[model samples]
Target: MTRPKREPRRPKTVWLDDDQQRAWRQLLALVMELPAALESDLQRTTGLTTFEYLVLANLSEADDRTLRMSELAARANSSLSRLSHVVRRLSDNGLVIKSVCADDGRVSVVELTKAGMRRVATAAPLHVAKVRELVVEPLTKAELIGLGRAAEAITDRIADSG
Candidate 1:
């Protein structure tokens, strides 16, 4: 028996209005520029890339200054493979130590060392100041709260889609 032919469905394309287009383009610009600016600031002040600083900072906040590699990857918004490479580099620099989890030999864990703690402590103030200068200082309290809510909503949508 022959099967009947079927029509392909096209996705709906809703074009943005002028105001929306302008707002969207501005958001895109901010996304691109903000990370670059923050990275530059971090690199200049601490000789660390933003990702490296994030890794260190996240670890510094954990209890006992330790986290499982997988957990760290999640917290850093990184893939396990990418986190492994960075953790290795950090281990070599004595900023952190990588070890087999004591409770689970099959699992890997990382601990921030005194050197890492010190580095993050030194970098935190500079990073915070740069963040305030670029992001917070220009916005009113209401605007900041609105921005936060908007971000959370977008993030929730992204999570749902993913």
Candidate 2:
């Protein structure tokens, strides 16, 4: 049998006030646009989504190109379940491996495969260029610094509240 459809959220309950609306729209646009743009570039050049690339990049930079699954999830801005799903895909692609952590039997760690390292090395420059083209070059150096600070502040706020 088919499942019943879920009801949609009512607009009045979810809608934002004027200032919140403006901020929400701008934030939403950045949220949607930035990932799509970066992911497209990554996909075009390295055949990976931004999320996948982030997974590899984080692993590659970690000591031994590895991290505990729970930690990797946090660093990659993904949930443990989502990270597991992605890691499974990466494992299938032979770009990452998951196994029991030596220090903690209950935990798993993810490590970059040699192929994943090579892929990230090849993709990093092109990804950086795309970032410059879409985000960095348009701003003054001061604005760039401010952008970093603002992003960190927002991240902290989100983390605190979340």
Candidate 3:
């Protein structure tokens, strides 16, 4: 029996109106510039990349300063492979240790070392100051709340689509 042929799909185009175009442009500029500025500040002060800091910070916030490798990658917004590499580097530096989960041998877990805790503790104040200087200090309370809501909405949309 012959299979039926499927119809070709039409590509949909979204053309932004003037206000939307302006908003998109501003968001685009922010997406391009903000990370670089933050990364530069982090690298200059702590010799840690933004990703490294994120990994450390997320681990610090976790219960017992430990998380499964997969969970850490999601929290860090990193790929599993990338997280593995970063974890290896951190291990080499004595910042974190990775071991097989006691309950599940197939699962890998990462725990922040005492040294990692100390490193993050040292970096936190400087990072917070930089964040205030670059992002928070200039915004009014209402604007900050609006920004947070906007970010949450956008992230929700992205997460739903993906």
Candidate 4:
């Protein structure tokens, strides 16, 4: 069938104003730079990548030092595949053990070994010190609280969008 050609509609685009632009750029820089800086310090001091540290740390904080694979992935903000790969590495190092859940054989669970607990314990202070130096010490308490609120709001927005 013959039809008239029509222009495709474009979505409306809203431009950021100056203050929003500046704030966004600053946020972008922080997002890119802060993690790298923290990872560098953690690697130098603890011989652990940030992801590894996070996995260990998260496990350390869980009930009985254990969590199901999916739950761990969520807590660490990682995909199940990536978490499984890292868990494999940790298992190889005897830092964590993975097994089928007793209650649900379909589910896998991870538990921190004594060695893993020790590793996280040792790494924690160094990590906290670095965090304090880079993030906390520079800000007043009120500003830090406000920052926390802002971060929570941003994370909520992201979670809602997804």
Residue-level lDDT for 17 in candidate 2: 90
Taken over the whole model, the C-alpha lDDT of each candidate is: 0.96, 0.92, 0.95, 0.98
Which 10 consecutive residues of model 1 have the lowest summed lDDT? 2-11
lDDT of 3 by residue, 21-107 (tens): 999999999888989999999999998998999999999999999999999999988899999999999999999999999999999
Stretches of candidate 3 off by over 4 Å are 1-14
TM-score winner between candidates 1 and 3: 1
**RMSD of each candidate?**
1.5, 6.9, 3.0, 1.2
Instruction: Please identify model 4 stretches exceeding 4 Å from their true place.
Output: none
- State the lDDT of candidate 4 residue by residue for 50-157, as single tens digits: 999999999999999999999999999999999999999999999999999999999999999999999999999999999999999999999999999999999999
For residue 22, what is the lDDT in candidate 3?
100
Clashes (candidate 3): 0
* Model 4 residue-pair collision total: 0
After the best TM-score superposition of candidate 2, give how far the Cα of residue 138 lies from its true spot, in angstroms: 0.3
Q: Count the backbone clashes (under 3 Å) in each candidate.
A: 0, 0, 0, 0
* Winner of 3 and 4 under TM-score: 4
Give lDDT tens digits, candidate 2, residues 70-153: 899989989999999999999999999999999989999999999989988999999999999989999999999998998999
Residue lDDT tens for model 1, 65-159: 99999999999999999999999999999999999999999999999999999999999999999999999999999999999999999989999
Q: What TM-score fits each model?
A: 0.95, 0.82, 0.91, 0.95
The global Cα lDDT (0 to 1) of model 3 is 0.95
